[model samples]
Target: MKHILALLFLTAASVMANTAHAENIGCVSTTWRVVNNDKVCVQSFKDPDIEGVACHVSYAQTGGISGALGFAEDPSRFSISCRQAGPIVAKKPIPKKQEEVFTQRMSFLFKGLNVSRLVDTENNSLVYLIVSEKVIEGSPFNSISTVPLMPWGTQAPQFQLK
Candidate 1:
């Protein structure tokens, strides 16, 4: 039973997770008391399975000695905005909705921020969502963005959605 629960937990955590690496854009000091001031920062990453779509996430990063040493738990306050970096190309078929497309650990353990994607076939757009959660608790703080599907080079995506 213990092994089964562990498997379920791991599976839930990584379901459809692309796990893209973040490229730090920059950071600004939000608090002056700490050496490493608590600051809101922006980072960019691209979808591994879907080419040409990139996302920019901004969140509050913990500061001070703990944050400097990577031992602080960041607050659940982040936003996501996905856009067409170049041409919209889905190497894999877009799902109606997936569990998660991106995830970033807020702390060292089971606490982190998660991003999921939804296909809006009616609007012909892709919607991305961000939610902060913990193993024992969850945050209501969340964000969303959408990218409409259109021709990149000369034609739109050739794939059909269900």
Candidate 2:
């Protein structure tokens, strides 16, 4: 009986810890706004994998109860901009082409916003693509930002093949 109780306690604690970690890393409410007759708010969060970079994500709210249901019905429309608030040190080199580093649900019905880090080899800069869309439905809007690496330092990693 004691073993069973210990197992149950450990499982519960792990579950709670996972939930807390997810909430901390993904989305956290930041600001609120009034648009038209509805209240529009922006929830800003940073990418867990990338340091010194912050993304400000803003979205409009649809009228409903104050819970998950309400947010689900809300439109998936969103805007994002990633800026280097501090010195960006690449612990691991980022790859060229499109790669989704972070993703979160903006609304129900298969709607989500994804943040991808792309390497601009030609320009020697970093590009971030913010895409918002529904699963079955397509998106007509997207945004991007390019941060040029300072000439003094911050050069892309060089890989030599054997």
Candidate 3:
């Protein structure tokens, strides 16, 4: 059917878009269970709109029967680290305030992990933060890391923060 094909195309497009932003770099086993093994997943991603900057996030992933069934919510705690991987360059005007850079579903519904980027114009730095959100409420737990923009080579392009 036309509707079914459209739906499939949209679903595939969304999945591809998410993958373009981030990739699972590593995962570590945490708790053991009869149904499945718990894990802490680590992912590396680049700022979708920025060049020469990358970030890593590590978070606890639920396990066991519920998790295996995609019915579990991951923990709210996570860590983030952002660094200047090369000559920092902003492809577009970056806001001085916080902006959501990346997000991943923590549960099947109503729960997610998000990473935000903040531009520090005065310090010539970028701050990345990780937090958890729920449909009804959000967690106060968060982690942040910073990267200072500096010349990597002679041709380091100017980064603009508006």
Highest TM-score model number: 1
Candidate 1: tens digits of C-alpha lDDT, residues 34-146: 46889999999887767878999999999988999889999999889999877777776666766467788888666888888888888988888999989799999999999
For model 3, what is the error of residue 47's alpha carbon versus the real structure, in angstroms, after optimal superposition?
0.4
Can you write out model 2's per-residue Cα lDDT over 30-123, one digit (the tens) per residue? 3432422344465555545445666665665554344334444555566666676666655455556666755655554256566677777778
Taking all chains together, each candidate's TM-score versus the true structure is: 0.85, 0.61, 0.85
Off by over 4 Å in 1: 1-17
Q: Residue 146 of candidate 1: its Cα lDDT?
A: 92
Q: Ranking by TM-score, best first?
A: 1, 3, 2
If both were scored by lDDT, which would come out higher, candidate 1 or candidate 2? Answer: 1
Give per-residue lDDT, candidate 2, residue 51: 55
**Which stretches of candidate 3 lie above 4 Å from their native place?**
1-20
Residue 111 of model 2, lDDT score? 65
Candidate 3 overall Cα lDDT vs. reference? 0.82
Point out where model 2 deviates above 4 Å: 1-37, 66-68, 151-162
Tens digit per residue, CA lDDT, model 3, 1-162: 799767855764574464327888988888888887899999999988788888888999999999999999988979988888887778788878888888788987667788888877778778888888886899999999998888887856577767
Note the Cα lDDT for every prediction shown: 0.82, 0.56, 0.82
Candidate 1 RMSD to the correct structure: 2.8
